[model samples]
Target chain A: MDKNKSINQSANKNESQSENQSRYIGVNEWKRHGFQALWALVTNSYLLGFIQGKIYKGRLKNLCVPGLNCYSCPGAVGACPIGAIQAVVGSWNFKIAFYAAGFLVFIGALMGRFVCGFLCPFGLIQDLLHKIPFPKKLQTFRGDKALRKLKYMILAVFVILLPMFVVDILGQGAPYFCKFICPAGTLEGGLPLVLLNKSMRGAIGWLYAWKNAVLLATIFLSILIYRPFCKYICPLGAVYSVFNPISVFRYRVDKESCVDCGVCAKVCKMQVNPVEHANHPECIRCGACKKACPVNAIR
Target chain B: MSRVFRSRRIGILLMAAGLILMGFGIHRGEMAVVFGKAVNICMECIGIG
Candidate 1:
C-alpha cells in the first residue's frame, strides 16, 4: 500500500509540473491577445458613431490610421489607407496618392505587420474566430510558400491596377477592392448602414447581396483558418510585409545563447519558423515565439 | 550584414522622400480634395457606387 501511494504521489507531481509549464508558455499569448483587443477598441472608439448610427464627419476623418479599418465604419474617425489609395488612383485627373502612399510607407517602416496583429479590427475578428474551439485548418507546409504570394497579386490588381485603369463613360474609376471584395467594408459599413437606415434597406440590391455573401464566406473560413484574409488577400498586409526585414519594430533572436527546440514555431499562429526566419514577411510580431522560447533566445 | 544595413538606409531615405513629396502635395491644396472625399460617406465601400 505504501509503494502504491508513493507511485501515485510521483505521478501527481509530474502532472502538476507539466501543467505549470504549459500555462507559463501560454500566458504571454493571452496577454498579447488582451492587448490586441484593447488597441482595437481604442482605435475604433467613436462610441456615439455606433449608437447614433452615423459616421463621424469631423476633421479627423481626413487622416488615415495605420490599420485596415473601414473609413465608412460608424465608429471610424480616420480614413482607410487602402480606400484612400483607391480613391486617389481612380480619380480622372491621375493624381498621385502621395499622402496615402507616404503614410503607408512611414507606418510600414516603423511597425511592419505589427499593425495587422494588433490594431486591425478585421484581424481581431479573425483571431477570435480561430479561438472558437474548432479543428483549425492550417497550411504550414510548402503550399504556404506559394499561398503567401497571393496577397501581392490582390494588392496590385484589385487595389491599384484595376482602380487606376477601369473607368466608366464619365472616366470615373471604381474602387474595385472596396466595392467587390473587402469584408471589412461589408461588416463595418454595409451591414450597419442597411440595418439602421430605413432608406438604405429599400436600396439593398444584388451588389449588397454579393458583398454579404463574401462576408459570410470570410467569417466561415476565419473560424477554420487563421487570418485567411490577412494571409491570402490583404493588400495592406502585403505592403507592410515589404518592410518586415527592416522594420524598426521587429523580433530579435539571440544566436549566441540559443538552442533551437522549435517551441517558437509551435506557438506561432502565423506558421513562421521564428528560429530561422524571425523577421519573415508573414511574422505578425505577436511575441508568441518570444514567450514560447524555452531558452529565452527571442526578444 | 552590411547588405541589410544598406537596405535599411535606403528604406529610410525612400520614406523621407515620400514624406517630403506628401508635404508638397499638402501645400498644393491636394489635402482639401482628399479630405473632401474622406468626410463624405464612402458609398463605393458599401457597394452603392
Candidate 2:
C-alpha cells in the first residue's frame, strides 16, 4: 500500500510539473513584437500597414531582423534587404545590400530557426493556416536528389545573379525576383497596389499576369501542403539555414535516449532526417518533434 | 502504379482545367467584371485598377 501510494504521488508530481511549464512546445501564447510589425511591412503595402511608427524616430536599418520584409510596404521605416539589393542593382549602386547582409549574419549567428519560428511573418502565417481542420502530411526526399538544390539555384541565379548582372536598356537595375518571380511580392505588394490604384490596372501585362499566377499557386499549395514557399523556394530561408548548425538556439538530439522509431521524423514539417543531423538547416525548429518524442529525446 | 506520378498527372490536368477556367473567367468572372467596369469607365486611363 505504501509503495502504491508513492507511485501515485510521483505520477501526480510529474503531471503537476508538466502543467506548470507553460512555455512548453505548443501552449505558449504569442506576444506581439518586432516580428509582427516587420512582417506587416514585408507582407502588406496598404496605407494603414504603411507609416511604421518607428520611421519618424530614425530607427531604419537593413537585414537587421533577418526576415523577408517588403521594402515597399507603406509603413516600412527601413529598407528591405532583398528590395535594397534590387534597388541597388537597378541604380547601378555598388554594395547596396551590405547592411541587409550584415543584419542577416548577426541575427543568424544568434539564433537560427529562432527567426524562422518566431520572426518570419510567412512562417507564422503558414503555421496558423495549418491549424485548420484538414489532413496534413510531411513529404521527404523521393526521387530527384538534384531537385532539392533548386532553391540554391534560385538564390544564386534568380535572387542574386541576374539582378546584379542583367541591366535594363535604361542602365538601371530592378528587383527581378520581386517583379518577375516572387510570390511574396505579388501577394504583399503587387495585388494591394493594383487593387487600390485604378490607374495601375492599365500597367497589367504579361509580367503582372505571371506574378498573379505564381501568387495563386502558392496560396493554393499552402492550403494543402505545409509551407510550399519555405520548403522548395525561399532564398532567404536558404541563406539563414547555412548558419543553423552553429546557431546559438539549435536543436540537439540526444541519440542515446532516442528510440530511432522515426516518431520525430514523422512529425517534422521540414522533413529533416533528424536521426542523421538534428540541427539540419531545413529545420524551422517549430519544436513539434520535441513535444512528440515519448522519451523527450529531441531537444 | 506510381503514386507520385499519378498525383502529378492529375495535378497537371487540374492545372490545365484551372487555366481554361481562369482564361474564360478573365473575360467573364467577378475579377473580369471589376476590371471590365473599370476599363470601360475610363477609356484613356492606362494604369492600376
Candidate 3:
C-alpha cells in the first residue's frame, strides 16, 4: 500500500511540473509576439506615407533598419540594409558601402539573429502565417541542411558578386535580390503602391508578375514551414548567423544542470540541440529551448 | 581568458571597428548616397519594371 501511494504521488508531482512548464512557455510566447508586433509597427511607422502612397523622404531614410524591410515600402521610415549595400556596391563610383557594412556588423555582433526572432517585419509576417491552423506542419524535410546553405550563396552571388560584376551600359548595376527575389519588397512595397496608385498598376509587367508569384509561394510555404525564408533565403539572416557564436546576446547552456533529456532539441523549431550547440548559427534565439528545458539548464 | 570574457572582448572590439567604419563612411559622403537612393521611389528596384 505504501509503495503504490508513493508511486502515485511521484506521478502526480511530474504532471504538475509539466503543466507549470507549459504555462510558463505560453506566457513567454505571448510576450515575444507582443514585442515583435510592436517593433514592426515602430519601424514601419510613417502613417502619412501610407496614406499618401509615397515613400518617406526624410534624412532618417539614410539609416538602415537592421532588418529586411523594403525602403520602397510606402510606410518605411528607414532604409533596408541589404538595399543600401547593393546601391553602394552597384553604383558607378564603385566605392565600399562602409555605413551599411558597419551597421550590419554592429547589429550582428550585438544580437545576432535575435533581430530575426523579434524585430523583422517579414519574420513577424512568417510567424503569424505559420500560426494559421494547418493540417500538416513540417519541422524538417529532405535536403533541409543542404538548403540552409543556399542563403549564404544568395548573399554572395546576388547581393555582392552580381552587383559588383554585372553592369549596365552606364556602368550601373541593379539590386538583384530586391529586383528578382525579395518577397518583402513585393508584399510591402509593390502591392500597396499598385493598389493605391492607378499609374503604378499600369506599370506592372512580367517582372511584377514574377515578384507576385514569389510572394505567393512564400506565403504558401510559410503556412507549412517555420520561417522558410529565414531558414533558406535571407542574406541578412546569413550575415547575422555568422555572428551567433560570438554575439553579446547569445545562449549558454549550464553543464551542471543539463540532464541530457533531449527536451530542448525536440522543442527547438530551428533544429538546434541547445545542450550541444546552444549558440548554433541557425538559432534565431527564440527561447523555445530555454523555455522547454525541464531543469532550466539553458540560459 | 575564459570563453565568456573572450567573447565579450571580441564583441566590444567589433563594435568599435563598426563605429569607426561608419564614421569614415559618413566622412566620405556615403550617407548622402544611401539617403539619395532611399528617398526616391525606385520602381525598378521593387520589380514594377
Candidate 4:
C-alpha cells in the first residue's frame, strides 16, 4: 500500500510538470496577442465616432499620436503627424514646420520603430493579414534590397519636395503623397466616409479609383508578405528607421549567454539577423526574434 | 553612472528640446493651423481633393 501511494504521487508530479511546460509554451503567444489587442484599443479609442458617425474635433485634434492613424478618420481624435507635416510644407506661409518636425523627432528618438511594431493601426492590419495561413514570400531577390530604399525616396520626393515645391497655377503646393499613395487614408477615411455619406459617392472620381486600387493592392500584398507598406513605402517608417541606431529604447543582447545559434534570424519577420545586426535600421523591434532566442540572450 | 545611462539622458534632453520647440510653434499659432486642417475632412487625403 505504501509503494502504491508513492507511485501515485510520482505520477501526479510528472503530470503537473508537463502541464507547466505546456503553459509556458502558450505564455509567449498570449503575451503577444494581448499586447496587440491593447495597442489596437488604445489607437482606435474614439468609440463615440462609430456610433455618431462624426469626427471628434476637440483640442485633441491638435496633438499627433505616434502611430499612423488617419486624421480624416471619423473615429480619430488625434492628428496625423505625416498629414500635419505635409500641410505645413504645402502652406504658402510655411516657416519651418517646427511643431510637426519636433513631434516626429521626439517620438523617433525615444522609441524608434517600436511605433511601427506595436502602435501603427496599418501595421497591425498587415500583421493580422500575414497570419492568414497563406504561403509567405520570404526569400529576397537582388532588386529587393535596392527597392527597400524606395520609402526614403518617397519621403524625399512626395513628402518633402513636391509638397514644398510643386505648385499649381495658383501657386499652391499640394500634399502629393496623401493625394497619390497613402493607403491608410483610403482604408480609414475614403471608404468609411463614402460608405457613410451618400452624397459623397457622386463626388468620387478617377483620383478615388486610383486610391482604391492602391488600397486593394496593399491589402493583397500584405496577405502574402509581411508589412509591405512598412518595409517599402511608409514615409513615417522611413523617418523612424533613421533613429533606430540612436533611440533611447532599444533591444539589448547578452552576448555572454548567446550560443551563436541562428534561430533568431530564422524567426525574424523583418528579415533582420539578430546576432549580426540587432539594431539594423530595417528592424522594427518586434520582439519575435527575442522570443525565438533559446538561451534567453535578447531583451 | 554607466555610458548607457548617459546616452539615455542625452536622448531625454533632445526630446525635451523638441517638445519646447513644438510649444514655441504652438505659441506662434502653427498648431492652430494643424488643428484647423485636421478638424475638417481632408478630401485630398481621402483621394477626393
> What does candidate 2's lDDT look like per residue over B1-48, in tens digits?
486455345334433443454344333322322222221211111111
Q: Estimate each model's TM-score.
A: 0.87, 0.67, 0.91, 0.88
Docking class of 4: medium
Q: Residue B35 in candidate 1 has what lDDT? A: 71
Q: Cα deviation of A144 in candidate 4 (Å)?
A: 1.7
- CA lDDT scores, all candidates in order: 0.80, 0.56, 0.87, 0.82
lDDT of 1 at A96: 68
Off by over 4 Å in 2: A1-64, A131-141, B1-49
Which lDDT tens digits does candidate 4 get at residues A15-36? 7545533443321444665676
**Candidate DockQ scores, in order:** 0.50, 0.02, 0.74, 0.68
Off by over 4 Å in 1: A1-28, A139-142, B1-11
Quality of model 2 by C-alpha lDDT: 0.56
Please report the TM-score between candidate 2 and the true structure.
0.67
* Candidate 1 lDDT, A1-299, residue by residue in tens: 99999999888876765654465555345676787778767767887878777888888877888888888888888888898888888777655677788888888887789998887888888888877776647546567778889999999999889888888776667889999999999998888877888888888888888999999999988887789899988999999999887776678799886655566776777888887888999988877788767679897
Error in Å for residue A54 of model 2: 16
- Off by more than 4 A, model 4: A1-30, A169-171
Candidates 3 and 4 compared: the better one by TM-score is: 3
Cα error, candidate 2, residue A156 (Å) = 0.6
What fraction of the true interface does each of the listed models get right, in terms of native contacts kept?
Answer: 0.48, 0.03, 0.71, 0.68
What lDDT tens digits, residue by residue, belong to model 3 across residues A179-216? 99999999899988888888888888999999999999
Encode model 4's per-residue lDDT on B1-49: one tens digit a residue. Answer: 6988886876677688778878877777789878988998899998898
Model 2 residue A281 lDDT? 79
Candidate maximizing lDDT:
3
